[model samples]
Target: MKCLIKECDSYDKNQQWDIVCDNLWKLPLSQSVLMIGVLLGNLFFGSFSDRYGRKALFNFAPIICFTSSFLTSFAPNIYVFTILTAITAACIVGMSQASFIIGRIEFIGNKYRVLCVNLQEIVYSLGTVIPGIGSMADIQRTDQ
Candidate 1:
């Protein structure tokens, strides 16, 4: 079992992984994996969607995203968690933002397309920010 944190005191039962930060060194690595995945997804999926149609990627990526996300929660170790996180991040970008926005734009009238995209951006921004706010709030962790 690979462990990301050398000094973490808490263990997650589902993922069988460590929790809480004793040092910040490994945190950036985790974030970097997600960003790299997103970059790869954007680069690859953009061309893929263009060639195969956005609808197919839009329809398929979410199923992959959801499955990877579900599996991430139950990952047996840090390595699996990292791999799954990358997959989840890739799928989120490929399915939610790129394919979805393009697909929605194609179906809307010219005059309404900008408005539709702006609305989608607003919703997506809120969805991203709200959870971050919740996470930032103080919450005590308990041991069983």
Candidate 2:
């Protein structure tokens, strides 16, 4: 959302009415598609990971994610970028979550399983914080 907001602001400042309108109209649709993709990918991959093994999936997902993200960064237009972004979100982020949860559960003893699950919440919070810190840097840079 922050990135979209930044792009919109850039277009608005430049008086690029067509680009601005296109971006504004498409934001909701793009978000909806991404949400659906995430949900569906999660459901499909979660079961597949259970049947197969975590190590292979875990290692492979990051490669797909990184490649998709790298390609997205260089996308020629918004449509291509959005499609790549959705693919990254679905294959990379969605699959990673499923694999991580399954792998985390399998590794720990039954007694410590609950604690481990709770610990993941803390780790995820930390993950959010790292990006929040980067976003603050982005804010500062934009202010300049």
Candidate 3:
């Protein structure tokens, strides 16, 4: 139970379901759904791209990702937020791995392909790390 936890916030203490979801434990379920979406997106898009052409899927994937992300911000409840996040995750995984390689490699000259790939890796790494860095900064600021 949340009461057993050492750091239950007011959200947990007051039993506030009118303002937010009562179940904080649903985070893992939401994350699992998001990963499932990612897996499905990769398999579906990988095959779909092969069948329909990578270019179309390459151009379209970001739109799907963006739309889901945009909708997620306005979600009225945890269920909608979770589903939208899952969709966003799916599109992101599919587009990042599948479309990125196909589109990036084909557009650039042979001489610049390696450089492009390297840049992509650098950008991806930064994207992954920035969140952790931001979280650390936020924690430090709050501690002050």
Candidate 4:
């Protein structure tokens, strides 16, 4: 979200409407599609993980996310970047949450599941907070 917002702000300031439109126009559509896809993917993966296993999908998801994010960062054009971002959204972010939940359930016992999940949420929030603090420090430095 921060990255997207920063990109949009930069484009706005530079008056790069063509690039911005090309990159952002399909984002809403992609987000909606990914939301639906994530729902279906979660249901499918949740069932599959229960029957088969979670390790395979859990390990593979991070690789897909890293690769897609790296590719998107280096994309030559707005169209390619947008497509890569959409693919990342669908394949990486969409599947990763479900995979993580399944993996956690498989590894941990039932009694601790809720606590473990909540802890995970707390950790994620802390991760975001760290970056926010860093950004705030940067702002303070610039104001000096």
Pairs in clash, predicted candidate 4 = none
**25: Cα error in model 4, Å:** 4.3
Candidates 2 and 4, the one with greater lDDT? 2
lDDT of 1 at 38: 94
Model 3, position 38, has a per-residue lDDT of 89
Model 2 CA deviation exceeding 4 Å by range:
1-18, 119-144
Instruction: Note each model's CA RMSD in angstroms.
Output: 8.2, 8.6, 7.4, 8.7
**Least accurate 10 contiguous residues by lDDT in model 2:** 9-18
Cα error, candidate 1, residue 90 (Å):
0.8
Model 1 Cα lDDT, one tens digit per residue, 1-144: 344544467655522444445433456777898899999888877877888877788787888889999999787776687889999998888775565655688778899998988998899899999999999999888999
**25-89 per-residue lDDT for model 4 (tens digits):** 65566566556656655666566556666666566656776797899777765556656665566
Number of colliding residue pairs in each model:
0, 0, 0, 0
The TM-score values for the models, in the order shown, are: 0.60, 0.61, 0.58, 0.45
Per-residue lDDT of model 2, residues 77-133, tens digit only:
656766777777888656767656767877888999999989988999999899888
Clashes of 1: 0
Residue 50 lDDT in candidate 3:
78
lDDT of 1 at 25: 48
